[model samples]
Target: MPGWALALPIALLTLIPVAAVIGAALSPQPEVWDHLIRHVLPRVTANTALLMLLVGLGVLCVGVPLAWLTALCVFPGQRFFAWALMLPLAFPAYVLAFVQMGLFEFAGPVQSRLRDWFGSSAWFPEIRGSLWGTVLVLTMAFYPYVYLLTRNAFVTQGRRALEAARMLGESAPRAFWRVSVPMARPWIVGGLALAWMETLADFGAVAVFNYDTFTTALYKAWFDLHNLGAAAQLAALLVLLVLVMAAAEQRSQRGRSYQVASSHCQPIVLRGWHRWVAFGACALVFAASFAIPIVQLVLWSLSTWREELEPRYWDFARNTVLLAVGTAFIATTLSLVLAGVRRRHADRITAWVVRLAVIGYAVPGVVLAVGVFIPIAWLDNLLIAWLRPLGFEGFQILKGSVATMLLALSARFLAVAYHASDSAMQRITRSQEETARTLGLGSWGLLRRLYLPLLRGGLLTAFLMVMVDVMKEMPITLMTRSFGWDTLAVRVFQLTTESMWENAAVPALAIVAVGLLPVVLIFQRAERIQGA
Candidate 1:
């Protein structure tokens, strides 16, 4: 069989879930739509739009300036903040949401201390379950997506265009506004769209904050309402939103390449007050977003460790690790296969198939849970029908099983694994393959002898990346997990749902620890990109 054929199954797997969702949406669900359009749609659409607008502006305001300061100016701790700013990415947005609420809520320590000091009448702003709180939590958590891309664009392209604008007698501010910002528009806009997509797809953070969005609506449709049709319809709508956002992002990247790497242009040097201003700005963002929350989580964890570190906590940890490890291995192997097929064939069929297979990453996990569960449930029912004649009266398979969860998760994270594997695979020269062919080695032998060593780092990266993601994933597992399969992410969700943020801290901390590996790898890659 041709190598391209290998990806057909993988591609089909991705399509089935989306197809199932859309198909269910098309089917008449009068009762469901009556409930949704009346009670759900109006509120969800408004909240989603408002959330996007707020988050869009918030991320840009917080992220772009930080990127500019860290990239173009010589400021105190510029090097450290360059990477440290991304640390918030290590904590899932939901984790950050609860942590912030834990600290800032009316009954929490900060407010408690304030009420004690300044009397109960002291006007303190309420953050929990409010727009300000939701936007702030999401902005802090997601700004790294914007900062990473824009900072790289600045670091590589540097002040070359800025120099030209300066030569044209443009004011420094005007020069930056005209040259630098426009030049990095694609990255900035692309990053913004990406953040918006994440914001739109988010379930846990919004759920924690009691903010209504499509994701939360979808979750309610399936679990709360027990209406599969409604869930599928909601997922279908979300899929459309994702598609639109993707189109906008694609359009942003299509123009002439603005990415120009030149080392000659140096960073602008700041004088006394200006230097301190830059330092303070970076420090404040870093502290608020990452360091402070992390410290609070650790303290909370330490305080509650004796009780929260019980056997069930270990069970959650074990489940989290198993899910992460299982999904990572499956995703990595399949990704490596898809990557190999694309590399060896270089045909459109394979290329398109690979694209389809990897696109599951963009689809929200809750959508995947619904889409995946429906088809598998149908198959399980079919098996029961077939086995009934042989006295297998109640035999059920693939529904609410670990295999089902793994499949859904693998679909969701396959892209992460594929990108890592494909990148490493690209580093192998064609000449090496030709030489291996000349030596009469078959495909297996070539992969075993030549590609294995070269791919080790990439596969490990893929594994770790997928592992961390699975550890942090909430909606999918929450929706589809088998009985007693609760994970750390789920534990966090449970506690946050009950407003028990302190107890949720230990598990959140563990997940954050695992998540930090990828952030470190990301920073290392950014350094490499800058150097290159």
Candidate 2:
């Protein structure tokens, strides 16, 4: 089939859910909107805005200083900190939330120990399930997004700018603030935009904390209220917020360029106590973000081994692996085809279609779940009606099936696979394709003998990236999974909701272990960026 022919189906599949979302938004019930606006909308909007503000401040406070230290200064354990700081990326915010609650709740170890030392009436800070706690956990998990981008910016570009300021008699700190930071603002803002988008899309973490945000509000509207139209309207509002953020980010970046004249500039190196200070700060952030939570999880897992490591746990793991592997394979294959087609036949329509398909990544998982479910429910009804005349009464195919789950997962993660494959394809010169065509090789032959060989690394990278993301995905799986379709993520959510943090630890650890793959990849990529 021609490249465009293959892309057309993928584009249509991608757009169906989006169309459903729009349809739902347009057709909301009058009563639901009236109630939502009077009571729910204002509160949800305030909480979401406040959460975003706090998270943004928290990420900057932690991520920016660490990025500056790692990029510009020599320190004790600098090499280790460079990668270790990113290990928190392996943790989902919800997992950390449960772990922190386990360690700090009223009956948990910290408070118990405090009561042991002092009186039961003694004062201790309340840390679990609060807005501050949620902000802390989310910042720990997502600061890497800012750190990675900002560190790369500082290392590759800020050094020259900083030097120019120093030559004009500015002090070191003054030069950093006046020159290096301004030059790196674009990248820093871009990183913050990514962090905020992830924050807005998050459901599991906020849900666990019992903090009402837009994601949780959307979930409640759909599942709790059973108001699909209200859910869709909420989702539309969330999408509009995301679009505004994207536009603001673009506008902030307008008329400014951060690229340096060269990528080979030497970074600054600290000495003596300055180095130790940098080292201690990075170490503290790493310990709080990654090491501490993981250790707590391990301790909890060991205590609950008999219960958590049973056959049921294995089943959840198996289901998770199956879904993740299946989604990765299918998504990567489709990405390869779409990217290859675009490469071979570059045109405006194909480019626009590809862009439209990849936009699914920006949609929140809960919104995507609702969008996907609406169509699948409709299609299942149509199928059952057709099948009833053939004597297959009460037959249902799409709803509550792994097929629907895969469809949702593919729509959610296809952008990851596509970008990875597209990057790989761009590196393969067109002359190679010309050379293959001269040998009378057709498209399939070209793919088999040439493209596959060249794309092997990229395909695997895309697969692993998608697999890791799928393993940690929460809202989509939680909303869509059938009976007996529990994955590790869903198991974590179930246990956490029940306040069974010890039992949740096993699956949460499994998710973190799987998530480590992409974190390692990210670390390696950051190292390469700096080393360049």
Candidate 3:
């Protein structure tokens, strides 16, 4: 079969949400547009841009130095810190937001204690609804994107380059700024690009902090204003913003090559106070980002588990599992199909189709939810109109089920599964396929007998990654789920929205625990890369 047979449908499916958002935007809603332009757009634009700028700077500050220290320096606990620095990846930004807020909010322990001790406590910096605190939470949650990419770049750059710079009489710090960092510009840019994308897509964390950005604006438009068209228009703007950023990132790396020799990287030995200073920096970030938040989450969970661990909580867990597991199976299977098509066809059209199909990863969950719901609502209305004469009344079959949530989630995360599958497919040599064909195996036979066995590990990884992502997802689950289908993420959102931070912890802890599954995979892979 031609690749277009599969690739076209997949690409079109991926395009549904974008098309919906764009189409909704084109239809003139004068009142909504006027209101947004006059009142909402100015603040939203500034807030979103400012947040992006701060987060961009924050991640670079937090990720680049730590990556350099971990990859190219010898210090106490260097091996442990290499992986420990990335532990924050297992905590969703929203979870961290609530944990931090709980600690520093007016009634929370820190401020309350300060008030009691001082009888006034006017000097303590407020955290709830504070922009800087939101930035801190987001940076900690997202820095791994930069660290993972930049560290790999640094690792691949052998010590010879640094030695060359040193022999030219350049000081260590100066040489690092001049040579090492510039060589890793592409990787750093890519990492920053990923961080920007997630920051743009974020909702739960900002929502918890009561900070306003495009996501929160779009959400309020949809739910608070009871206006779906307005929400769609806002989502369209966000979609365009993401596309521009992604295009810029692609253009920046277009003609750049940062490849280095395959020689092993020998770390620079730290002497005296510098050794402890390096250790202190890495330890501080790890502690602030991972250790504190986790310990607080545990404490909060312990305080509330008695009341929160009832049967309804199980329902939330069950709902979370059902959505995650269902999406994982869907995404993993589709990823394999797309990967197989790309491998077999190797045509320009097929490659483009696959790329388009996977762009859903950059689309925000809230945007996906709105874009996806429009078509389903339309279909449901049509169904209701047609079936009313047959006594099918008072119900929306499609809109009243889990199908829409699953579709939005699958669309949001299929790119992740596709990348994993594509990488795995690259590992299978053409010779292996040819040999299998010579043994009288057809395409289906080869897939069943050869590809499946070899690709099992990668597909499994894709499944787990997708599952964990879906579990932690908030906006899609919040906006798209049918009534009574609340998952742990949705529960966390609701409780945090109500400022019940302690109540949100049980579910938040569960998500963090599940989030560790992919983190372990990442750690193991990084170790393998380092070993090689």
Candidate 4:
């Protein structure tokens, strides 16, 4: 087979969507472009950039210090705080936004209570419908990405490097700035890249809070104005932005590897106020990230009616579970296959295939959905026409069905699963596989007996991460969900859009409910893996 023969399928798969985006871009609409450039594009672009910058800085300020403390301190409750800080990842961005808006909005309980207590003349700070409010909500939801990556990087660095800096007469803080941060830069930046992508892809929260970014604008164009091409163009721009960020990050990480000797596994020691201060800092982090949002969500749910238990609510819940489960399973299976194949034959093709598949993680959900849908629709139309000659009627099941939504999700989320499996695979030495081969074990036997068992932790983590991602996923679900099939995410967005704050609380709580199980499971598994 020729090289193009192998490359053809993937190239065709990619080109179909790029072609659709190109067609949308070249839709002969100078007037639309002129209107956009003259009115909305500049404002949206500026706001988007500002939000990204603020969120990045906010996460760095709040998250990096906490990660360092957790990684290198002997604070009270440090053991618990170390894992619990990751709780923020389980809180969906939109759910956090909804809860925050409820607390801070004018008629919300916070202000209402203030007014009642203070004769309705209290000048409480305004938090909703502002750029800072958007930043606050997004940072709370996104900081975990930064924290986890940076913390892992610090832990991977072990204590030797920091101790060596100390022996050279460097103070703890100065040594940290000089050595630790620079070493952790690649991982931290990768995590920040993910955070930026999440921010770019955000719609439900930004829309609910009345902030306009490219995503919200694209959503309004597609849904309200019925302008699909405009949305596609906006999505194309977002894709370009993500690609640029990815390129920049890759360049910054030109020659880096995450490796450390086992001898440096001894933990660092914290003395005096550093210990107490670390505890206080972690307490503050928990209060802001988990305690506040959970309390607000619970309070809102209790204050609301049971209208969410209605049949329609059940349907949405059902849809949400189906989508989450389907996407998790597909993503896990595909990742396992790719991981296994790569393990068996470490060739350029296998490596590149796996890399290409996981690049979906960097692609924003909405952008990927738009990219996916265009080619799918094009193919459906082409197929329907071609099949008509064989007496088949119109058939386009993938466009507006659970299948399309799940595929889009898997494409966007396979990296989480792949990364998990990839990490676990790294822990297993090639020597083990060679030993198995010497013992007359073939590829299948080695995988079945050794690889699968060793990779269990990764598999579990991957499934949980993908499951959480699917539960909170909104953009692609909104684009491809069938008319009657509303996921909990869609319901939350719709109810919020309609100002049915109480109704939205139900689905928001449901999302929280769905997230907890996997979170607890992942934490337990992570503990065992880390301890081992």
Candidate 5:
């Protein structure tokens, strides 16, 4: 098939959910809007804004300094902290939220010990179900996004700027502030945009804290109020916020050139107290973000091992693995096709189609879920009605099946695989394809013989990324899963919702464990890039 012919169907399929969302948002709902505006909308907007602000500040504070330290200065444990700092990416914010809440809630160990020491009511700050607690947990879980990008920016494009500033008689710190930071602004902004989007898209963590963000509001509207239209409207609003942030990020990157004249550079070496301070700072962030939460999870899992290790645990694991594997395979395969089309038959239409197909990644999971759910439910109903005339009964394939869930996952994560494959494809010179064509190889022949072999590693990376993301994904899974189709993420949410922290620990730990594969892979890739 021709490239545009292949790309058109994928683009249309990708746009269905987005079209559903836009249609829902445009549908009339004056009463719902009134109630939301009066009772919920303002509070939700304020809380979401506050949460974003807090998370942005927290990530910058933790991620920037750590990136600078690890990328620039050689200090004690620098090599270790370089990768160790990324370990927190394995733990989702929701997992960290529950772990911290379990360990430090009013009736938990820390407060109980403090109460014993005082023998009365002592001043102990609450860490559970609070806005600040949510911010802290999310920052720790997400700062890795900022850190990884910023460190790469610093290492690759920042040295020349810093050295030039130093030669101009600026002090090291001054040079870092005025030169290095500005030079790395585009990357930092990109990372911050990602972090902020994740924060807005988050449901599990904010739900755990009862923080009432837009996502929680959307969930409540759908499940509690039984109003899918209102939920979609809220989702649209969230998408608006995300678009605004994306615009701001692009504007920040505009007119910025990150190229450096020289490719060779040396990492700065710290001395004495400066080294110790940098080392301590990195250690503190890593421990607080990764080590402590993991240890707590391990302890909780040990205590609840007998109760947690039932047949259902295995069932949940199996379901999670199946869903993740299926989603990864479908997403990666479709992404490969779209990317190949773009590479082979580059045109305005193909480019636009590919762009539209990847936009789902920017849409929040809940939004995508609602958008996907409503349309699929409609289609299922229409099919049932059409089939009933032929004596066919109970034909509900799309409503509550693995297929629906996979569609949502694919919509949300196809961009990941697409970008990976596209990058790999771009690296293959046009001469290679021309040569293949000159050798009498058609599209399929070229793909099978040349592209597949060349893109093996990229395909694996794409598959792994999508698999890990699907494993960690919660909102869409929670919203769209069929009856009794519980994955580990759903199990963890269920247990956490019921305040079964110990039981939640098992599934949560399993998620973190599985999530570590991509983190380690990414870290290794970054290490190789840095070495080069």
Candidate 6:
């Protein structure tokens, strides 16, 4: 087979959108380089760097200690706290941004209660629309990326190493700092890389808090100034920022390998200050990151009126669920096939194509939208032209349909599904596949009967991950939804824009509530797997 033919589909689809963006970046009569150099770009880059750094440090602070305590200590509700801290992963940054803004806005319930308690104009803490507030919101929503990765490392680090450190006269804290953390550095960096990528990609939270970042600037350039080229240039800058972070992360993880346990090693049991301290710390972290936002959203949702609760809202709810489910299923399915195909082929063409497919996760939703639109629209027009010869009407494969949304979702989320399946496949011994083949089981039979069953959990987890992502998705949905169509994300976006906090709260909470279902399922599944 021709190499390009094998690679062309994924490569062409992926790059067409990026090419369109570059084309736009080049076409604005003259580049906006002068304006960007003088004013917007520098400030936006600085703020973006600041946000990424703060969020990175915050996650390390909360996630590392929390993971260690849970892994080593016997605290009250340790398992509960361990899982609950991850609950924030289910909450979208945008929804949390709205919740925080609603609570702390000048006229919000927090200030209102303070006014009623004291005299008018008495002191109340100013939090909303501040850098601190933005950091808190992002940390709350994105910390789970770090928390889960770190905790898994802590769990797998085993007791033998720590015991050896203790035998050598190392204190528990000293042992953890010197032995545990250094060994787990790769896992920690991987998680931090994921979190930082999310932090940079975040648009809704920073935009709502009125913090100037690259995404916000790009949006403004496109929507407000009517300059696609300027938006593309800004996007290119953001891409450069991401690439720098990626390089640093790669360097940090270089020459690190986390080998599986050589033998069963009992973990240390906790006592004294260790247990209580662990409990207190985890409780505070969980309460701030997950519990607070969920409770606040639920409270505001309850206060919403019956008349305002339109039945059409349920239709939107259904739409959101179906879209998420369909997208997750199709994306996961495609990823599994692609991952398997790449493994079997072991060729640069297939490997690079799969890599390119996964690259969509790093591309911001708005960037992905622009990339997808060009080919989809062109294909629609081509089909229309082709059908003119017959009496048949024009055909549109993707434009303005749920199909288009699903395609975008698959492209954007393929990484999550691919990684999940790939990891699970790695866990199953290669000997199994070899043995099955020796027994005269054809590749089809081997995959169908053996590999499929083992990977079911990973595939399901991937589906849930993608589904949650699709539920929280905003930018692409906003850009691509057909006229008169709406999802809960869109409703929340509209209400937030109109400054209708109460109305926004309804759908914001709805999005989080619906999004968390898969999270709950994943937790239960993980528990079962651990127990087994």
Q: Sorted on lDDT, highest at the top, how do the candidates line up?
A: 3, 1, 5, 2, 4, 6
Whole-model Cα lDDT per candidate? 0.89, 0.85, 0.90, 0.79, 0.87, 0.77
Q: Candidate 4 vs candidate 5: which has greater TM-score? A: 5
Q: Candidate 2, residues 387-494: lDDT per residue as tens digits?
A: 998987787688888888999999899999999999899988989989999999997899899999999989999999999999999899988887778999999999
TM-score to native of every candidate shown: 0.97, 0.96, 0.98, 0.88, 0.96, 0.88
lDDT of 1 by residue, 458-525 (tens): 99999999999999999989999876779999999999999999899999999899889999999999
Model 5 regions more than 4 Å off: 1-5, 120-122, 389-396
After superposition, candidate 4 runs with Cα above 4 Å error:
1-19, 26-28, 167-169, 255-276, 383-397, 424-461, 521-532
State residue 28's C-alpha deviation in candidate 1, in Å: 2.7
Give the top-scoring candidate (lDDT): 3
> Candidate 5, clashing residue pairs?
none
Pick by lDDT: 2 or 4, better one: 2
Winning candidate number (TM-score) = 3
What is the lDDT for 269 in model 4?
74
RMSD of every prediction:
1.5, 1.9, 1.1, 3.4, 1.8, 3.5
Instruction: Name the lDDT value of residue 68 in candidate 4.
Output: 85
Which pairs clash (backbone N, Cα, C closer than 3 Å) in model 3?
A: none
Flag regions of model 3 displaced more than 4 Å. none
Best first by TM-score, ranked:
3, 1, 5, 2, 4, 6
Q: Candidate 6, clashing residue pairs?
A: 17-371
lDDT of prediction 4:
0.79
Q: For each of the candidates, give the backbone clash count.
A: 0, 0, 0, 0, 0, 1
| Sequence-dependent TM-score of model 4 | 0.88
* Candidate 6 residue-wise lDDT at 68: 78
Model 3 clashing-pair count: 0
